[model samples]
Target: MSQPEELLDESLRAITERTVELANPGSGRAVAALRRLTARRRTPALPVVVVGEVSRGKSTLVNALVGQRVLPADRTVTTSTWTLIKHGPSLAGQATVQCGDGTIETVPVNTVAALGTYLAVDGQQQLEDLHGAGARCVSMVLEVPSPLLESGLQLIDTPGVGGLRATHRQATLTALAEADAVVFVIRPGEPISASERLFLAEASEQIGTCVVVQTHRDQTLKAKAALDADLASLTDRQQWCALLGDQERADRVVAYFRDVKGISVSSRNALLAQDEPPGPVRDTLLRSSGLQMLTEVLQHDVVAARRRVRQRTELQLVELVLRQTRDRTRETVALLSGDAEAARILEDRRATIGRWVAHGGDLWRRRYRAGCARIPDELQVIVDRRCAELNTDVGRQLAAMKPTEIEKAMKGVLGLPAQVFTELLTEVDTKIAAAAAGVRELLERDGLAQQAHQTDDDGVTFERLGDGTFTRASTNLSVEDLKHATLGGMAGVGIASSGALVLAHAGILPGALAAAAAAGTAGGAAGTGLAATAATIAAPIFWPFVVGAVAFVAIHQVSRVRARTREQARTVLATVREEIAGTALTRALDAAKEVGRMVEEDIEAGIRELHDEADRARRDLADATTLTPAARLARISDAEDLLARVEDLRAEAAALAGRI
Candidate 1:
């Protein structure tokens, strides 16, 4: 194993065994989860989830990947549930359906076409009605015989009807959770809609590997070229351009996939070419269709990405447990030092917190809100200006590139918002930290903590955070319920530098695809990685950010750009700019809402923590006053031992985080 993996593997073992000694309930849960992950690590294959907007050819792409017509894919049919296809001794299918009252029904699917009957979301009401009132198939598992399946790779075909939107919201999240690699299918000229962007943003966090395929590449380009001669289709020489795809936003919504591996493959053509006798026509069709290259990506790029993802997941689990353990230790240390002198300090400190909240809480909240209110506009100007700059740079770069290189060229052009968003979050975190420092300086000026012991960092820490992190920032115990709650499952490890990821209990994080990209280029210390992770989880609005952000239509159609008049190219660039600005503006506004909520939550959290701490201190003080000398010494010694062990684990965690 490589060094990082070796380090992680060794840490996992240490945490699993040593954590059991901590005698903390939270550590017990972490140990359980770590052990579960350990068992799964022995089985290395990560399921690939194939996804797309309605009728974007997700099913077809899955079939292409399997190199067989195992799944039904007709224009009239739409997949409406999760279907897991794995290697089986024979071709067969089974489904799990649920009634409105939440009763589950099992159904046997005997044939390939029958699988379609259970899978279709439209044009098959009669077949669906057979299931009974309020009954809907929630999921299915199909056993398909294929060379691809033999390799232990699994593919999940997602439903198309509510695919990209919110109707099957939880179902979509389930897919995100299970996927180690994603195959995002789109047709020629389809700009990722806002909803698609939202889902991808979340999915990007769970897994860094994605393959974006533009289906109908050959046909769309040909038909589009004919349209340039005044709107024509296969059947009519004067058909409207709308026959090809949605063009109302064509001028404004340029097809852009950012930071993803995209290939334009004609899935239909690949299927047809398979049946043809060995010849140049067949060879050209398969090669030019981009099917061969896509298979390579699935076999190579995406498969390799899964390994890296596993490492990150292991890191997140270990880090969360370590932090929780640290907090427990810190609390223990404070309790041990609680005595006649400490009791007086705690009472006064708690009283001070009470007074501040009563007098200054509302004003602090307002100030934070005011700070957050200006973020949208600031982000808008930056995103707009960035896109505008990219338009010129992209046009210049594209002018000399071949069609095949367009995807490569555009990948570098813009994954807008990801970078801008990262920079913004870093700024926000820095400000929050600085504000905490400023509060400390003010306390020193007034000598409010004049009696606070210099040797006790806890007093300083709690006082500084009394109105900030010290109060509001506590372990969410989120990792115990991690899998379903949010992207925190994917994030907690890398960004614990500020303790924010562990503190915020963020159920949402910005897209990691872009963050990971930024981390690579901005490589410095673990602190930098923490800033990047905070940037992601802190801003969920950008969860609806960018895809591989390349114009795939231009990528596959080599001669099309050359044929376009300069006027047309300029128009395309103009639309690209508008698309970037409009999308960013809408998402920025959404982000502003999250920013406000988080800001308010942070302040409220502080207030809540203050009251809780005060109550705990009052109880601990009473206990301290009542303790016998011998008993007090025993508890103190025990607490000290726990605190030392915790500190050692924390140092180990810190070292590991630095490598991230």
Candidate 2:
């Protein structure tokens, strides 16, 4: 490293260490960003994306540049996903598949051609079927042992957009958006398409540099000239205005694209000449291929541009850390003097936040209550519909069933209420999540209210709680318990059997009330006796009139029993809705209250910290007053040393900024 690089490294290390020592709550994100910046400084790479229409020689150019046939090239739209090529100790390849649920899977591959298996439509379909809907092939990674990749140059080969689907165009555009620089390859015989021209115009706005390459120079020189003329016309402001349909932007874009440098290269000749000894024939082949000029342009333009971007990013991060440190130092200095004005401002701010805490709690409660008020009615509608549907279906079945079959069919309908309760529970969960989100939004808004005070003031602000904290309270109920409760409640109503007496004894419901409700809903003892008699009426032993009377009585009693059961089930559901809604609202309010308490506690902690700082300042003042002359001189010397260190860091930052 040179003097400037060494100086920058030292300054960044100091900033990172100082941030760690300060350990301010708000500094966590800043510290993490600084660490990443420091790591990037250690191993910086310039990302260059190779893009073009199908069969435009993008992959061929990349293979020639790397001096290895690592990327597969063909006449068709061969590349299907973005492939990042980098330097490794040895050749390696991997494919990264992103599933619909935001999970990533890495599949190792043995050859570059094998990558197509993952990127192809058939492969994607298989993956989708395996991973379920919305799964896709995201991107691929390839590592090669190449000299160009070793010197901090990363080349990305992208899918061709020409003659392909609109999705391919979108994927290419997305790649271009993140590229540091772009290489647009064109064939000699074809003029730039409308899509390519539009893409170039958009790339001009997003990327720092773009270089055009005219491939297949082995073709007629006249064809190359024609392509060059076409490109020159495309860059003209008037043509761009016609192509892009924006006057002011056309002017800007034309200026950017006008001076874009283009080089002609035959990748075929370049690849063949790589193994030949130096001679006139070799020189001629390399010159005609234009590989030498391309290398020089990449080194001078693309590499330098990347360096500038990296330096600027590093400078920004350093300045952020410096500003934070200075702010903290200023606060300490104020505390050292035990400033009465500072104490009064802090107290006033604390009082303001306390008022917000109280008011916000009440506001959140009102909003939560109002949001939950509609849930019961919504649940009632669902329950009523489900119940009516069950009744109609059961009534039709009863009309057709013989006497012996009636009891068996009616048992199935008894379990229908469990399904309704389950659906209602799902709806309740959805509402609770919504209510929790509302409460969270309210808390966040109040949290940001302190930002205005922070601009002209210096004190700790409340950190907003995480999402899990707000949602946990409302989601405490277990689905299994709900399922069991619904089933148990249905079984107690005697729709299936005389087992209702057993459920009553087991105290699933209050004993006498359970017995009475079950018996009444089951059409009383008379109804049960009629059903028993009807079961035997089908036997040959029963007389004809007796069988007829039993059948009539059994049908009538079954109807009466079903009607009573329907009304009782509706009443039970209504009660369940009230209980569940009440529980959800109570949990929501408790969560809101917890948030308010946290805010109040955070403010109180800030007040205590300020008081402690003031106390330390008082002690320091006393010590200074009691210091001997020799001790005072020593203190002055220490202060001078710190001042010199500060000046040195400031000059280093300025020099780094100039480099950026």
Candidate 3:
């Protein structure tokens, strides 16, 4: 079992440890997030700071509680610096203060108040210079009041706001932020002044408690009555009850408090009347009305503060889990996209491989046929030469007609149907436009609207976006549009015109001339052979020669047919290339476009995981609590599921990258 105060102290310690873990420099996200988390109700202590008009005894309260008059309380701007008094194990300990020069000064306990003096005399030429320097010139420290070591609370004292001569009001406001609870002290009959109300609203945001105190109640009984009456006059009775709380309405011109015991006393008279001063004068006075009431109220305030701190810590943990889940989801989506892109690239290359095979086969066949086809044309040219050399009338007519026939054949062979090519290219244009439109939609999905390739009046152009996607207008396929044309037309002309010329030239001589040549060859005319003329003409050059001519004509015919075949083959090849390229482009675009969708999907999944983990962690945290000093110390450990969630988020990131 633990005491009430001890339990509170243990809870505070646990909160601080958690805060430290969240602020750890080793954790990238946690370190950055700590500022946002801690900015909201991070402190665990009940801040009780005393404030009053100049020479109205603000530091006196601090000195009384500390059981010493060590704090300067003279008439001439005493306690010029903002001093922070909090509980610690030792009175003299490490204190960190931000000096007026934008630097931190670590000093001992006693010299903490000297920060203002140091800046005023040693560095700043005048009080005005302090205003120019800002909070960097101010110092922060955990001033250990030995009396408060067992109290587990803090007390802050600030200079007067209304009558502190030549001080920056901003500086006073800045100093006031260090306190969690403020005791606003006023002279009798001053009833919640306008300045105090304004101060309360501002301080309420930074500090947890806002209390009003009317000091020097014993100055006059009449004055005490007047104070109560004036408070009623200044504010609506109902509102006053709200600010001061319904409990403290009985006390007039006393050490009044909200939600805690209030007391009134003439402390000055009590101390002076005692002939022998107690060894600890400050301690004796602290037991008096205002200070004693302040302590009691502080204890109550500490309880509420602890609850607020716990709630805030829980909110922070939840936010951390949500953010981590979002990040993991994004990573997973990217991984999937990358994997899909890789697969698409492989598929595209395979298509190119198929095209390569088709084109190579066509070229091989065309080359093989070309040689055989050339023989007939050459033979025909030789026969024409022999007839022209004889200068016969028939030979002359044949020569003249041959040139015209050759010319006509050339014209006919070269003429190609442009309609077929035009239609094919138009089809290509339509399909390309469709692809472009589809890709644009995907780009827009990824919030990459700028990457859309445009076909607007400015002409077709590619636009690039942030996500590494590019857009281009569909290419046209005119004679210039022939990005993938090859050897089809040339093969057509060679086969068509050359074969016709060879056949025409071979049949030039009549059958009677053919018979005379055979007789001459059989009689061995001119000793060409031991055979007649007919044998000479027909024997050596007989069926084998005819066969050779026929083979040449066959090759030429085959070559002519291949001309159209080549064009069709190239068209097929182009279609194949387009299919492969279009598929790849579509896949890549799909992957890129779907990134946001993937992220959304993964985030939902991560949220589910986080919900489960958080529930487990909350249960574990509750179960681990024994609410005893020994047990609390032992069980105050990190949530098991929280640690696992962090690991899970990391693993999710890796998995996402891999899948992509």
Strongest candidate by lDDT: 2
Tens digits of per-residue lDDT, candidate 3, 27-134, equal 222322232224424444544566656655556556555655445554332323445566665444333323344343445544435433332222222222433232
Q: Please state the error at residue 316 of candidate 1 in Å.
A: 4.6
At residue 493, give the lDDT of candidate 2: 12
Residue 556, candidate 3: Cα error in Å is 99
Which consecutive 10 residues in model 2 have the weakest lDDT in total? 468-477
Better of 2 and 3 by lDDT: 2
Give the Cα lDDT of each candidate: 0.50, 0.50, 0.35
Model 2 alpha-carbon miss at residue 389, Å: 59
Q: How far is candidate 2 from the true structure (C-alpha RMSD, Å)?
A: 25.4
Pairs with backbone N, CA or C atoms under 3 Å apart (clashes), candidate 2: none
Compared with the true structure, what per-residue lDDT tens digits does model 2 show for residues 310-416? 44444444544444444444444443334455544444434433543455446555765575566767776776566566557665455565644555555444434
Top-TM-score structure, candidate number: 1
Please report how far candidate 2 places residue 652 from its true position, in Å.
22
Please list the residue runs of candidate 2 whose C-alpha ends up more than 4 Å from where it truly belongs after superposition. Answer: 1-43, 98-104, 113-137, 162-164, 275-284, 309-660
User: Per-candidate RMSD vs. true structure?
Assistant: 18.5, 25.4, 45.4
